[model samples]
Target: MHAFVVGVAHYPYVGKGLGTGPARRLLDDLGQVTVPEPSAREIAEWLLTAPRQPDDPPIGTVEVLISAPHPVKVRASGGAPVEVESAVHENFRAAFRRWLRRCEASRDNVAIFYFCGHGWRHGDQLLLLEDLGEDPELVLANSVDLGVLRARMHLTGPRLQAYFVDACREVPMDLTLSGSRPRALVDVPEPDGPLHPVDAPVFFSTAMGHSAFGDGGAATPYTEGVIAALEGLGACRKGGQWAVTTSSLAAHLQNIIDWNQVGEGNQEVRIEGQWAGRGVLHSLAGAPMVPFRIGCSPPGTPLPERVTARAMISPSPVSSVQVFEANQGHLSAGFYEIDVAYPPDSRFTGDTILWQIDPPNEVLSLTVRSRLPDRS
Candidate 1:
């Protein structure tokens, strides 16, 4: 599994430098904070959370981080200068190296990469906004070319590939309260197929097109969203690969802040041989990867995965009720390995009905706190 980031804020940015401004913005966005200052409570909330995406069962070993934060400082809509410094790329590179070392543990065994600079979208094509774009400093794609990306994912083994983006187009726009919300999706069309045998899963902080907002000090919406959805959720264990639905986490982020960037949808790749449709799951060890079938039932949940059970007892005067733990993300009716049984809750305590589970051991019970809360 790997994590890649590309942040661009300022360049030739009123001649302020190169990468510092956007670097801060990237950090703040991943950190979910704003410049000059951010909320303390948000910081605390993000700090306590952990990475919730399941990526375990060791697929060989190679973690990479690409940092491209080219500061192209310019005033946002409010005449406020965005802080982007070229030197910040060096800082992020060092941070990424350290991060790679900390996660991979074996220095000699890890694959590491970091880049930061300016990027621009020319029609459907995404290009770097580096000084070289004008035929001078030699600009390269800050967001690597799909051709290069394919070459890279092939090396990621057939396991999983995870992605995180905190980038927003360096364009200008005005915010309208009553205005239509930015479409949650921004798509860059593929030449043909989306199925990539080397592709596993991807998790992004924000959608494309939209600008991501973060106070100077907090994590950006993307990182903040990851932290919030994963923290204390008790979904992960040591050495396990986890696949989360983009929609579920996207919904969670809606309640946090108004994330500026609206990312494009999934991009599958092309392949050949009998393994043509094979995705990155080919390299996933232990359990076989279940491909997501549109409109059809998805793969079943692994037996080892812990399930989050949400139930409703129908607060009405009914004496009997059913406890349903929705399959939601890929878990199914057949996956409930735990034998859930209930005796009955004939007693109502303080306008509340206490429901009970069986075996004198089932821990789930409904409180009379005004019938059971229905998490519809």
Candidate 2:
């Protein structure tokens, strides 16, 4: 697999805090961010250290670019840390070309692209590079038109392509009134031959006209959710093996965002383009562990101090038991018989709850009902 990743956090010309300059004055309304650089580095680390099955493709090349106040370094598997390039327009274009060339070496290769930074929506998504607004006359000279880039990717050799855009889709007021659109950094001629058969899936961090969020000096919530999904949370039993497919990953991301309340409660991830339903992004050696919530029905029923929850694998002796802490825990994917026990003197009674712990649906809620009093 080949990957190209970019994170632009130091937009000297677009935001405040930097020295007063012509470029900064032209686009000082936008705010500066501190999350994209870390987010990009985290994604690159995962790509380098991600586990793969025997049949999976090995990591080929990873080209990363980050725009930050200081030099950024990343380490590959079994290698020393290396400095990455700045996410300037020239650097990004060069890195992209190199990544595309590497991916073109084989049609079976998987191509991945990720970008996190300030972005705007003007009929299409426009990703701002580090040098955005440097040219006062052409404010978008250093930006990329995401839609055009995706269309050009159709002419690439790789059949499976995944794109993650972790940026805002909010429309800039100036651009909205001016009706100006940004041009892509790179342009490709129309293909004379028929376009290649490509399954390109684009994952946007937020819905149209929405802004993505991140904690200052830390990775964004979207990036954290994505890494978690890629690491196994998105895997599902497919053809007798656990695999993380496009659909499963999407579902898992949404679940994580909602369950964790990662962003502003209204932020929603959006998926676009044609997805290969069975395209396996990652294959796991074993079943995925999923989080589960256990509670008694008839909400807030009083229970004894000594309560135990045991989850036994169906048709097998293998089981895991937690004493009182089973109200919330992680369980491996499978059909399980859950037994919750309460003290004899407690109003709540023990009950058996059957549950199917599945992947993608990482969080499962199981409710045990209390046995009624013996009126007879």
Candidate 3:
């Protein structure tokens, strides 16, 4: 069985006063990112279940986590030096290692981890911020090392380790430091591996070397696409390993329309014995218990009659739905009789009909289908 887990750290306060915008955005939209213990069990059950297809595995498990959505963790050291150009001296923080510790209680056939937020590089070493500290020495990127993170994880049997990084800076690691203790950066050997499709002999782990960019019109595009891919694996094609191909993942995420560009694959990073591939991430992107609602104001456009018009009435669907100009078609579904505008759209003529359903990938399909005369 495969298991995935997550821990997050955040930094809310930047240079000045506290604001609600950034954190509030995460209120309902915080995607399920952590792999809990029960979730891990369930995943294993999925892989072991009788195969619906003789060639397919019946059960599988995956875990994911995203933290500090409500608030990026912040802390201050008693006497840390502050830049004179800086407006606010506040520092936010998150308990990533602690949460990771819980996730790593026991490793599986395959495990993946992801860390976002701020990172600094000193020499070849990379450091993720825990919180603010007065001691300037604590800020050194070398203080943390990838090998240390690997040792802290509870990888029991034979398994692959794939580390991904977005943090950009490099820092020197003092081999003498406690977390600096070096371990082999390779896969773990689990004697229990089933050798069948159930066991993921090939697993990839990723860490963004430098992903400190601020959230904007778009959240983390890479992360967003990654989550969508994991959430909709049924929509993906399977190679040897379970993967959501990059093109489809990008298309799913593109629906949000906030991102300007979408990246494809990670090249150059090497994992021992694992084939190099793009569009694959080792982080666990788990499904949420409930559907998350995301609401945003439409981009520069004339005010529609209703607030949810853009979401409710697609641009293309209105054309095939023709109604007498005077006797506008009425929908039996909701209290609000949405005022249908003309020109690009057709009016309804037949008995008022409305199906409470989500729009398909191409709203134009509905219009095209409606234009054809009734087959009956």
The model with the greatest lDDT is: 2
**Looking at candidate 3, what is the lDDT of residue 128?**
36
Residue-wise C-alpha lDDT for candidate 2, range 221-291, written one tens digit per residue: 88988987887887767888988888788777888766667345766899987677567778898988776
Model 2 pairs whose backbones collide: none
Report the C-alpha lDDT of model 1 over 1-376, residue by residue, as the tens digit.
2332333333332232333333323222222112212222232222222222233232232222211232233232334544433323343335444444343443222121222222222222122322222211222212233223334333322332333333333332221111212111113344465543432333323344544344344445445444434331112112354222223333333432222233633221111111221222111222211111111112231221122333333443323232334312321111122222222342212212233221101222222222254479
Comparing 2 with 3 on TM-score, the higher-scoring candidate is: 2
Q: Write the per-residue lDDT of candidate 3 for residues 32-136, one digit (tens) a residue.
A: 222221222222233233123333221243333333433221112333422211101121112323334434444432344444433443333333333212122
Judge candidate 2 at residue 12 and give its lDDT. Answer: 75
Residue runs of model 1 more than 4 Å from their true location after superposition: 1-55, 58-119, 123-143, 146-151, 154-156, 170-207, 232-350, 353-376
User: Relative to the true structure, how large is the alpha-carbon lDDT of every model?
Assistant: 0.29, 0.78, 0.30
**lDDT value, candidate 1, whole model:** 0.29
TM-score per candidate, chains pooled: 0.36, 0.89, 0.35
Candidate 3 deviation (Cα RMSD): 15.2
Candidate 1 at 202: error in angstroms?
4.3
- The order by descending lDDT is 2, 3, 1
